[model samples]
Target: MPKTQCTDGVVGAILASWRYDISGISPEMRRDYEQHLAECARCSARQRFHRSLDGALAVLTSLSALFFLFALSVLKHIKPLEHMAFKILGLDIYDMYHMLISAGVAGLCFSLIALALVLMATPAPSYLSGIAVERARLIEARLPERIRSIRLR
Candidate 1:
């Protein structure tokens, strides 16, 4: 019924409400939706769009996890520097250091959990892996002739 929806009638409305994703549904119950999706262009396109969105979310969460990990590593390396500076300034920096480390650790844990959830709740892992494979192929194609020939073996 919405202007953005290209599918006509009740099935379209249902699919739209579900964001065109029936991955959470049981196989038996999903058969109908699967059949409809196969027969319907608009719904199938919407399904692809939703899957891509899920994949992007997974990638973002994974990147966030990596960033948090990097922050923790940087903080670890700077701990001695911070201690020296604070000692010279005659300031109490232990509390601040502990707080920052705690925050970084918490952030890293939360992001990792989020990344895991995204990968588990959607088909993002497969989608992302497919993209990686394509990128690898592209890179390999650009390799020098000698290296390419050696790689083929």
Candidate 2:
């Protein structure tokens, strides 16, 4: 497929330098870029791709943290892990357990830090929240009139 070009080269170049993220800009500054994005197919698609990438980073870091937490919980509660460490691996159970616990805790901390960085440095939070708001509006629009009236009250 042929590559699509931006309708306005100057604004598109500016947006590209910012990775098409206009969320950090003041409203007055954002208006022109927003308008360009709305009008330009290429830039709009690029913006969408960048936002989705940010959202994916946030989700992966979150899942990594959760998995690390789950690993720590399993190590703490599962007796078989202790047995495997002692009998199968021929390792000191207490030492092995502590080592595994330390690794899990470190991994959890690292992932949490990554998640915090992603949330702070990208437009993921606002983009995801906008998606949620859109979804909520769509769902609310579809609700029965009686339920909608009840919700309003």
Candidate 3:
């Protein structure tokens, strides 16, 4: 039963939402908003709005669960690392066939994730993706120190 500072019109609207009035509320002067809404259509719209806001908040809670389900769907297979690497990169590295797939697959997955993140963050011409790819490669090359420096910044 907090004191409402708004004009009577707004107070009536809040009362109208819950179908209540100012005469016999708690502590003799406070108003229950829900009780007021039940008595008024205008206030009922506000009530519905509050419900919708709650629904929107629930959506954010479910988003992380959806992401978890999607990732589980994508990478749950317990396959050999080499096979996983090739599958991830779509590479035909026959020479690396005998090597362990773990490192290559991980690298490919990391690159793909970085690409996805960069794509999402940097909105620009399509050429930017290619440039990012090249830049990521150059950073990995003889300029390792430069890459480390950039990372610090």
Candidate 4:
């Protein structure tokens, strides 16, 4: 909240809090240390570490939730999927050509995206010109009227 660079005492406090929460102190002037952290820089770093950890944990939880939901949905549709593929199409249940196709498609997509990024960039002009575009334009503008007329013609 206070944008000013915090002191070392504050940093100690943040670290103390993390250590206390994880391992803990013998006697409870943990309160005093916490107060000191509120004033110091060391503790602020600890707070940032804690916040980053919490963020990562939250992300992990979200991803796991998504995975489980997808798995559940897949389970629900499994019978219909198998019947559609194996029964109707007469493909072997053990065959995994779909995986290869998906992998190929992913590779192609990544390559195409890379190619697009490469193509979208402005290529550096030839070094022999030895001048920037604006300077070149100015020089071209200052050329003889006869030369300009010839160019126009």
Q: List the residue pairs that clash in candidate 2.
A: none
Q: Can you rank all candidates by TM-score, best first?
A: 2, 1, 4, 3
Q: Tell me the deviation in Å of residue 91 in model 1.
A: 5.8
The per-prediction tally of clashing pairs is: 0, 0, 18, 10
Best by lDDT: 2
Greater TM-score among 1 and 2 belongs to 2
Residue 2 local lDDT, model 3: 29
- For candidate 1, the C-alpha RMSD (Å) to the true structure equals 4.4
Instruction: For model 4, give the RMSD to the true fold.
Output: 20.1
**lDDT of model 2, residue 61:** 99
Question: Cα RMSD to native, each candidate?
Answer: 4.4, 1.8, 19.9, 20.1
Q: How high is the CA lDDT of each candidate model?
A: 0.82, 0.91, 0.50, 0.52
lDDT of 3 by residue, 55-89 (tens): 44444434544554454444445343456677788
lDDT of 2: 0.91
lDDT of 4 by residue, 1-153 (tens): 336554664545555545423224545756666665566655555554554444444445445545555544554456644566667777665444455445545554555554444323312122113235668789889999999999887
Q: Best candidate per TM-score, number?
A: 2
**Stretches of candidate 2 exceeding 4 Å from the true structure:** 80-82
Alpha-carbon deviation at 123 in model 3, angstroms: 36
Lowest summed lDDT window (length 10), candidate 2: 80-89
